[model samples]
Target chain A: MKTGIVVFPGTWSDRDCAHALLEVLGEPVRFVDYRERDLGDLNLVILPGGFSYGDYLRCGAIARFTPVMNAVADFANRGGLVLGICNGFQILQEARLLPGALLRNASCEFRCEWVQLRVEQSDCAFTVDCRPGQVLRIPISHGEGNFFADPHTLESLEANGQIVFRYCTADGRITPEANPNGSLRNIAGVANARGNVLGLMPHPERACEPLLGGDDGLAIFRSAIHALNRVAV
Target chain B: MTYRAEVFVTLKPVVNDPAGLTIRGGLHALGFESVKDVRAGKYLSILLDEADEDQARSRVEEMARQLLANEVIEDFRIELQPEPALAESRGGGPS
Candidate 1:
């Protein structure tokens, strides 16, 4: 499947995502600059991590207004598969493509470490290869990764199974200590109600190969490819 | 006429302010024992050229709603004022 990785000023993860998709997965991928309004034809769009717009005002706040985001919004509205990682997740929330907002970590520190994530649901386009309650090792790097939502919105997300992943222990136990960012309910990832769009705080692209530590993140990318193939068929 | 506006953006009451908590902790370390709480926020100064005060107010309000603040997790207040020199000139006009 063809994939597009969006690159915004101050976005540092585009190359990593490109390497994961092109070199590792052998998928056709290209970089889409933030100034471009046209996304062209692509099966998937990945918003990679980094301090977009230098994390000015707030993380992902200024970059959300870039011209390409309008196109991204339209693409998502058309039911295209969109994956947002790290600051990209923050951008998705700022664009209102996803519910909730990411706030400063409870520890008030920029945390960079490997964390375990439990797949909460596998029905979505991003996590179809993962089983419910399956644990995956991934790395997270960010300062404002704490996710928050209002009571009503949080309830709807839970009821609709929109929560896709949660911070968990290595052996798959969900506990407060496993929550590196103090995210509400330990949410590490979430999908839109339709499941076509997903935003997460972890860097799956950075974990796509054993050389990078582990290949646990490959399942997420492979799952998207499988979903796209299904659509093509 | 030009209007100057100061916008204040703060997190919602229920939202956790980690930075504010750290600041509070720092104050405590410095022996500010009487400090009850500290919540940090953002302040922005904006200048707008509009025909009237009402128009300027509306414009600034829209800016705050659309970009200056994310209302889902934060609240914003706008303080609007006519340019000081312009206000003085207007007063002088009636002299």
Candidate 2:
């Protein structure tokens, strides 16, 4: 399966994503510029972590208007797998490909630390490799990662099993203290209702190597590859 | 006609405003104990050409809805004013 890693002007994590996908996982991947209007045939598209467009006028707000986003939106509508990490998640929400908005952390500080994530839904494309309630150690580096949604939307997400991951303790217990950001319901990641688009704040690419702290994030990518291979066969 | 739109965007009442809260805390530290709450937001000034005041208002509203404000967690208000002097100064130059 092939993957496309989108690179915006201020994006800093594209190379990390490429390293994880190409050098670490041995998957074919390419860098897609934000100015490009077409996304070539690819099984997965990744919006890596970074301050796209300098994170001005709200994180991912301006970046959503880039030419590449139109193609990404169309690709998602056609059921192509899209994984948005950090700012990518914000961009997806801003583009309305996903629900809710990311607000500033309650502490009003930029937090960069390893946090535990409890996999809430294993049936989705992004977490198919993770067992239900599995805990993964992934680091989140951002100031605006507080996820917020209205009551009705939150209920729908829960009912539809769209919540893929939540902040939790090392032992896989969900608690307020475990939540690095003040995300509602400790939501660290979510998928669209169709399950094809996944957006999360954690840097999975940054955690794919054992030398980089851990490899638990590899499951997220491996899961996407697994899902893509299933459809190809 | 040229119109200037001053748009104010703020978080919804239910959404937590961390920046606002921090500001309130700072106020308390400054001995303003009676400060109940504070809500921070963004202000934008946009200049556009339209046929009439109604058209200008509608266009700026559309702009706020489409880009300036995210309805999911924020609300926006726009104030429109005609800029006749600026329009005259342009003297029918390129928009």
| Candidate with the greatest DockQ versus the true structure | 2
Residues A46-119, candidate 1, lDDT per residue (tens digit)?
99999998898888889999999999999999999999999999999999999999999999999999999999
lDDT of 2 by residue, A129-189 (tens): 9999999999999999999999999999999999999999999999999999899999999
> In model 1 chain B, where is the ten-residue run with the lowest total lDDT?
B86-95
User: Could you tell me which residue pairs clash in candidate 1?
Assistant: none
DockQ of 1: 0.80
Q: Number of the top candidate by lDDT?
A: 2
List residue ranges in candidate 2 displaced over 4 A: B88-95
True contacts recovered per prediction: 0.74, 0.84
Off by over 4 Å in 1: B86-95
lDDT of 1 by residue, B10-78 (tens): 999999999899999999999998888999999999977799999999999999898899988999999
What tens-digit string does per-residue lDDT give for candidate 2 at B1-95?
Answer: 88898999999999999999999999999999999999999999998999999999999999888888999999999899988788877777555
